[model samples]
Every structure is written in C-alpha cells, then in structure tokens.
Target: MGFILLINFTQQGDSDDPQSAAVEQFVIGENKVILTMNIDQQVTIERAGQGWRLLPAQRLSNQLIEQMMRTWQQVQGQVLDIEIDRSQQSGLFISMVLADQPNIQLFTLYLLAEQVVVHNHQLDRYFSLPLPMFNQLIPTGLLINQS
Candidate 1:
C-alpha cells in the first residue's frame, strides 16, 4: 500500500477544538493505496506495524516534517506513498496507508520543552491517563486532537 501525507491547520479560535481531524477512507490496491487529505494541515498516517494514527492540526513542526521527509527519501527498497487532504481549512479528514508488510509499529514522537512524550495511538483516548510517577508532568506532545 502507498502512503499519504496530510497537514491540517486550526482556525484562530478553534485552536483548542478536538474535532479538527478525521479519516475519510483508505483503499489498498494491487501495489498502492489511494488516500485523500481534505483538511488544511491535518494528516493521516499509518506506521508499518501500526494500523492507523491520526495526525491532526499544525501540532507537527516544520523542522520535524523536514527531518522525517529527509529520512523517508533516503529509503529505496519498498515505496511508501503519501496523499494529503486539502479541502477544509481546519477540520478536514484525509486518508493514507503504509507498507503492506508488517514491521515495528511506526511511532510518533513529540518534543515539548525539556521532556519527550512517546506512546501508541490506541491508548491515547483514555480519560484518566496514567500519568508517569514523575513529580512534574511535562508538557510534551501536545494532544491537539483532544479536549
């Protein structure tokens, strides 16, 4: 399956809104998958072993994307394509896919201040998160898609 890259943005007052991203559809074909990113700055991505992960809003920094793209470009064996949704200004839903084979799940990493937050997408929806025992809960990985 192919891959798609989506980048969604939030309106001025909608910065705190959670309904800013959605997954429309993903079609896996003979050697590629077609995806749509109708959102402004939001993107949908699937890591090899990871089923699907929703990347919403402009929470992703330009530097991060550039770095990722550079690394992705150097790859030559299997091809991972990307599509972006660009219909809505802030809350657009797009679609994407990853390599068909299974592998270590792709993870999204966020850097906040002096801390780092890394976790799978599935457990991100829990209400009462199991905050680390650390005395300070660092503001790492802004969950822009949440309330």
Candidate 2:
C-alpha cells in the first residue's frame, strides 16, 4: 500500500490584494541563508526545467523548496498600524511577476528585535506575521557544493 504525505502551509489574508497572489519566483536575502554576515551573496530560487533549483548550484532538498513555495502561496498576517523603519535590514524579499505584465511585484519582510514585519509593495501595506511561522518560511542549512 502506498501512502500520500500532504503538507499544508496556508495562512488567511486578503485575497484581492495582488501581493497575495501566487509567487512564481523568489529571491531570499543573503543574511537569511548565509552565516558569514555578508549581505551581498543573495540567493535566488526559481523554477528550473521541471523542478526548483537554487542559484549558484547549491544543493537543496525538494521538501525544503516545496515548503518555501507553500509559505509564499498561503502567507497571511495582520496589517500593522505602526510605521516601518526603512533603515532596518530586511530578512526576505519575495517577488512575483505575471506572465502578461512586465512589472514585478516586490514584498519585503523586515525582522525586528521583537516582531517581524512584511511590506507588500503592490498593496503598499505592512503586515505582521508570527515570528515562529516566519522562521519556518525561511530556508536554512542548504548545502553549497563548490566542487
């Protein structure tokens, strides 16, 4: 007998918002994956051929990629009334591009000392997602093979 393993990572949010649309590609901030404190090595993950593959030839587990996509598709949070500090470093940057349109919608998630904030450029709104759930969305410990 074969068993199917299903995983759900959907979060409730405004469906009418363009930022809430499906994410076809994503470019995660460098600090989220790298441990050397350098913010220049940004890693981009997108659809390659038939499956997902990280840029620069990094080996990533299929499960990890699927989880990330699920988070992007089902991420929901409350819009914060507080102002965002632009000086603060961003934890993640998610971008979505439509096939018919030439513009790319950008979303930035800022990790603060006490809370996490996500800024949807398309909607021009600030959202606060649970710290634990945000952490799960960020991919880590990916193998970077340079051989």
Candidate 3:
C-alpha cells in the first residue's frame, strides 16, 4: 500500500504584504471504500457514483446495495483499548479499494458470539460492534453465485 495523501494550502484574505497570512482549511478528501471483496471470494460490492453493484449478479436490489454501503460508511463502534489475540478467533478478510487511494486496504473481522471486532490495519485500531450488525455489514446467504 503505497498510497500518499497530499494537502494543498491556499492563501486567504487580501493582504498586500506577505507578512500576515491566514491559511484556509479545505476538505482533504475523505477516503471511501469503493470496492470490497469478501473473505471467501464469493461476492464483491462496488460503488459507482450514487449506486452500487454486486459482482456475479446476485438478486440483491440496488437500494439494498446502497444501504449496505451507507452502513459501511456510517457504522460506528466502541473503541477497544486492549489488544486482541486474533489467532483464536474465527474471522473473515475484506479487501477494499478506497476512492482516492491508489493502494488497496485490508481488514480482518473477528466474529465472536457476542460482538464483531474489526481490526483496521491501516489505522492500527480496533472497534467492537454489536453482534446483530454483522448481518447488515456482510449479509449472509448471498453466496448463491449466478453463472
């Protein structure tokens, strides 16, 4: 992952002298996971503008896909300050392609009997989410691949 973020600074206000300067803050551009592949390589969800598409042509509707993407973006969790032993957990791998990043991001999800923990390797952080939200994040039973 060789993605580099570049920030541009612009001069604000009309100042004849270059002595006093106030820097204007602009959106550094948020990174969105435009494409994601499942752990089993069974399904792929990709974002195209305002819509989303499922690879292998699942029977899922566009509205549902959009909702799933929204959930992925808006979902929040409780921060876990401690480290988890990922070796003993049953987990899944998700590979994502951020909108503005050139490199792909990888994440590991450890599903427990209670909560779902996601390890954001990029940020080196962990989040603990509710157990039921797992279905919304990666809805099961969509693995019936079409020829």
Candidate 4:
C-alpha cells in the first residue's frame, strides 16, 4: 500500500526550457483514462472493452465526445486548503475511476453562486477554477437542469 504522487508538466511552445511554460501539477489519485470515466450528477461516460459510451445512451457527436474527454483528461485546478462538511454541502459528486486501480476516487464540486470549487476528499484538497470554465468543463446542454 504505497502511493505514487503524479505531476503533470507541459512545456509551452517549442522551447526546451521548463520556465517558458507554466507548470500545472495535480494528483491523479495514486498518480494515474482514467481507465474508465467520471460520474457526475448528470454526466456519466464509461469505457467498455475498447470503446467509450455515454450512460443512458445519450447521442453525442464525436467532436463533443472528444472535447469532453480532453477536458476531463487534462483537467487541472489550483489546490486550496479549506474545510467543509460533505453532508451539508450541496454540490455535484464526481467519481473518477483510474486505470488498474481497485478503489474509486471520490470528489465533490461546490458550484456556488459566485465561485466553483472541487473538493478531493481522498486528498483533502480543494481546487478552484474560473466559473466560466466550469460551465465549459461540464459541457452545455448535457445536463437537464443545469443553470
């Protein structure tokens, strides 16, 4: 039961210098498709055999699929230290299944009227992203009652 800390560092442009690009690092719940997918309040995409499909069999264009997958795969957020009760918070729950992992990574997204934050309960870490981006992150028209 040891865990490896995963870090993602993307170099910008064609420069070999690391400083040229901004580095964004976050944990992959044991440094890990995501062998599977993320389960949200209204979104659910899972990989079966060699293909991926949307839950309840929703018809999504290939382009939209690619866009969503890309966003989830490369999703990065600024880590924050905050305390909140999971039971009391009215937030969206996202469960991420990583490759070759027996456990499911649990997360909660608190979409406040003013700000949006994702809490990783496993790591006790909170992440904040631009409110506008959150809308784009989940994709519009995907949720039935999303505002």
Model 3 / residue 30 / CA error / Å? 6.5
| Candidate maximizing lDDT | 4
RMSD of 4: 9.7
Query: Which portions of model 3 show Cα errors greater than 4 Å?
Result: 1-39, 144-147
Which clashing pairs does model 4 show? none
- Kindly report which residue stretches of model 2 are placed more than 4 angstroms away from their true locations once superposed: 1-41, 88-91, 98-101, 142-147
User: Model 3 over residues 1-147: C-alpha lDDT tens digits?
Assistant: 223222211322243434332221111124355665454476788766667778878777777777666777667666565577766665676777776678777677777878888777777667778898777777665555322
Looking at candidate 3, the ten consecutive residues that score lowest on lDDT are: 20-29
Output the lDDT of residue 23, model 3: 25
Question: In candidate 2, what are the lDDT values of residues 41-118, reduced to their tens digit?
Answer: 465566655556666555667777768765665666766657676665645556554334356656776777666677
Taking every candidate in turn, the Cα RMSD to the unseen true structure, in Å, is: 20.1, 13.8, 12.3, 9.7
Compose the digit string of candidate 1's lDDT tens values, residues 10-119. Answer: 24436654343221111122343222212223354333232223355455554454443333223121111222222321221222233453322222333234332332
Clash tally, candidates in order: 19, 0, 0, 0
Better of 3 and 4 by lDDT: 4
User: How do the candidates rank by lDDT, highest first?
Assistant: 4, 3, 2, 1
Task: Give every collision pair in model 3.
Answer: none
Q: Is candidate 2 or candidate 3 better by lDDT?
A: 3
Candidate with more favorable, higher lDDT: 2 or 4: 4
